[model samples]
Target chain A: MSTNKIDPTKWVDKYSDYLFNYTIVRVNDREIANDLISETFLAGLKSMKNFKGEASERTWLISILKRKIIDHYRRINSKKGQAEVRIKYSDDSNEGDWLEEQAPDRLDMTAEDIMENEELGLAIIRCMENLPEKQAKIFKMKTIEGFDTEAICNEFNITPSNLWVIIHRARTTLAQCLEKNWF
Target chain B: MSKFKSIFVDCSKAGNCCDKAQYNEASLPEKVKMLVHLALCKPCRKYSNKNTKLTKLIKDCDLKTCTEEEKQAWKEKIKQEIALKDRG
Candidate 1:
């Protein structure tokens, strides 16, 4: 677990692509994603001793990246909040996004195909963005990433009932978003 | 029947496709306790069905894996950096 020894042999084989994609997905910016991925690796290596294999290697790395993303947004919102009043997600007038009808056409697309289709992926991502931070993250990790409820509860430090409420609310919110925006 | 009775009657134990586990996973008897409510609660029934649909949609949209080159690059970059950080 020691990051001290630059075992290029062991390192490069393990986590390059997954890290990159993770950063790309979260940051939605390639260069920033690249930097964040690097930062995640470095942090992981330094704290390698802390890697108890508790959540697997990849989750740990993304956890770091997630922090970075939050930091990025905090800075953005702070500045943007004052300069350009942010639109409240709750305001009901379609927020000028021109949401499409619910797409009842849930046919002919494979899971992999849906994931690859930027339009479909972005559609789901947009719905997620409308959720509260905690609910959105939990839903993404548990439902989208196939993480178990126990893992979600442990990671978020939420009660079982609370977890269910958050997840249920997230599902309901997402359902509404899809129906309103993409169908 | 009565409204409160209807509320109880309509309720279901979660996880039964009919009851839909995501809504609640209480036992059959527990669900029966809410049977009247379930029978009347359109929202819960729709919710259960929506949960089922969402679950399927999520499962069907699992992300695709990255290419080998992307994998190689990430590994190289992350490991080198880890080596540097550990040294500090």
Candidate 2:
């Protein structure tokens, strides 16, 4: 095992941008992403002795950062049981069907329209940020990471029903938000 | 027709079906229900279409990253904290 004590000061110059980008995309918040990068570096420093040189230092730091993000989501979920309550109350009206006025209009954007429109991307990210923290994390994991239902259920310790409900609510809220902001 | 009964689903159920279909978690019956509902209900159809588009947009969007100045400042702050801890 090649044991080179990784320099803490060098990490910022080397991996900060990469880590920052990785985290900002996942969290969709700059301040939180910066905090996560700091935490990841500290955590990596504490565990530096465990580094076996099996992976590059950058990869090692990234692994720590990913776990930090997951922990961040778990912490958000545990702090409030309101997510379930929100889901329950949201669909109670009209048995979850959209009202005539609330129903989304056709987006009418061609693939070219969508790809060329930078505003649309920003609108989506903004809407995602508006999502309840746990919902945003779950939506990112499901859609961006392509995590399967069982994996998400195992990670969140939620039932399949709960997962579906959270995702359903997240999508509904995103759709409504996008309709208001983008359309 | 028997085929119609197999596919028939209500609007409320169709909402759940749409979500399930997005995740590839829908049962055969649920998939059939969503298809039937989408074929018949314009609003639900629109909702499904938009939902798919939103997911695609989010998945594909080139999200902004933190700037170099921001990263450098965070790094310096973290280094300061580590030094303080070492001294104390």
Please name the candidate that would achieve the greatest TM-score relative to the true structure: 2
Candidate 1 residue-wise lDDT, A19-69, digit = tens:
554556566776676666666666666676666665755557668778877
Off by over 4 Å in 1: A1-118, A181-183, B1-37, B64-88
lDDT of 1 by residue, B11-82 (tens): 323323332254334556655654444566777667666766666565544543334465567677765675
Retained true contacts (fraction), each candidate = 0.27, 0.49
TM-score of chain A of 1: 0.39
| TM-score for each model | 0.42, 0.48
- lDDT for B44 (candidate 1): 66
Q: Which residue ranges in model 2 land beyond 4 Å of their true spot?
A: A1-119, A181-183, B1-6, B62-88
